[model samples]
Target: MRVVVVPPVPALLSRYASLTDPVPELRAACVSAVAWLVEHDDARIVAADDQARRIGEELLAQGLAGRVASASERIETRIETGNILVMANGSARRSEKAPGHLDERSFGFDSEVEAALAAGDAAALGGLDARLGAELLASGIGALATLADLTVTRAVMDYADDPFGVRYWVVRWECAS
Candidate 1:
């Protein structure tokens, strides 16, 4: 199994894009990460809400277009099977400019989440407090928790940053069946 983790940054959607990307590197990383998932024949998406799911779908669509254009034969698109694409992110209170404003606890909260993701510590992720995550404006805890039982064989951090006070990550995990 393969999994890709990304944030539901509206800027990732072309409709929300500005003339100049506010997050150039992040955007590139997201596109690249989603493209990797598109390599699979199908995928299941996990997100916090409809909007987030839409973002994931948009990314998947973009990836599919690219893939189809390069493929030798027609590609079939399906849903809710194969690799997993999770739309999630850490705290939004890391700094004064953060969406939830500065919270001294945000740093530690984000650090723990980041560590879990980087190490593919499914137990730690599953044990994360949903309430605390909400208080800290973390959006990925629920989805991460669902990964508790998966045995991750490899974890790669394609991107990690707290730009605009919102912690975002693009990580890929290869899990054993």
Candidate 2:
């Protein structure tokens, strides 16, 4: 199984794009990750909400040249060959310019999440405190928790940064079948 993790940055969507990409590197990373995910005919998106889900869907539509399966949650349970796209980010308080402003606790929290992702530590990812994540403006906890059920054999960190004071990562996880 393959799972790709990306941030739910609105700037990634074309509708919210600027004349000059404020997150050029991030955008390239996201597009590359999404393109990889859509290599298969189908993909299951695990997102925080409807908006996040839409971002995943749009990526598929764009990357796959409009060939996209209707987004469905049940497809994951029904198929074993498709990819999983997780739309989540670490925190929005990594710096004073961060969306949630500077929070002393945010750095530690994001570091832990980053470590887990880099190490492919499912246990650490699953054990993340959802409440504390919310407090720290981390939106990826729930999706990370779901990874506990899977066995991650390898993790490829395609991107990791806090460009807008928001922690973002583009990672690909190769899981055991």
Worst 10 residues of 2 by lDDT: 70-79
Q: lDDT tens digits, residues 73-154, model 2?
A: 4344424445788888987988888899988888888899889888888888888888988998887689888887788898
For model 1, residues 37-98, the per-residue Cα lDDT tens digits are 76866567889989888888887777777877733232234454668889999889989888
Tell me, by TM-score, which candidate is best: 1
Give the CA lDDT, 0 to 100, for residue 22 in model 2. 93
Reference-based lDDT, residue 116, model 1: 86
lDDT of 2 at 152: 87
* True-vs-predicted CA distance for residue 43, candidate 2, Å: 1.0
Error of 2 at 122 (Å): 1.4
How does model 1 fare in lDDT? 0.84
Candidate-wise lDDT, in order? 0.84, 0.81
Per-prediction TM-score to the true structure, in the order listed: 0.92, 0.88
RMSD of 1: 2.6
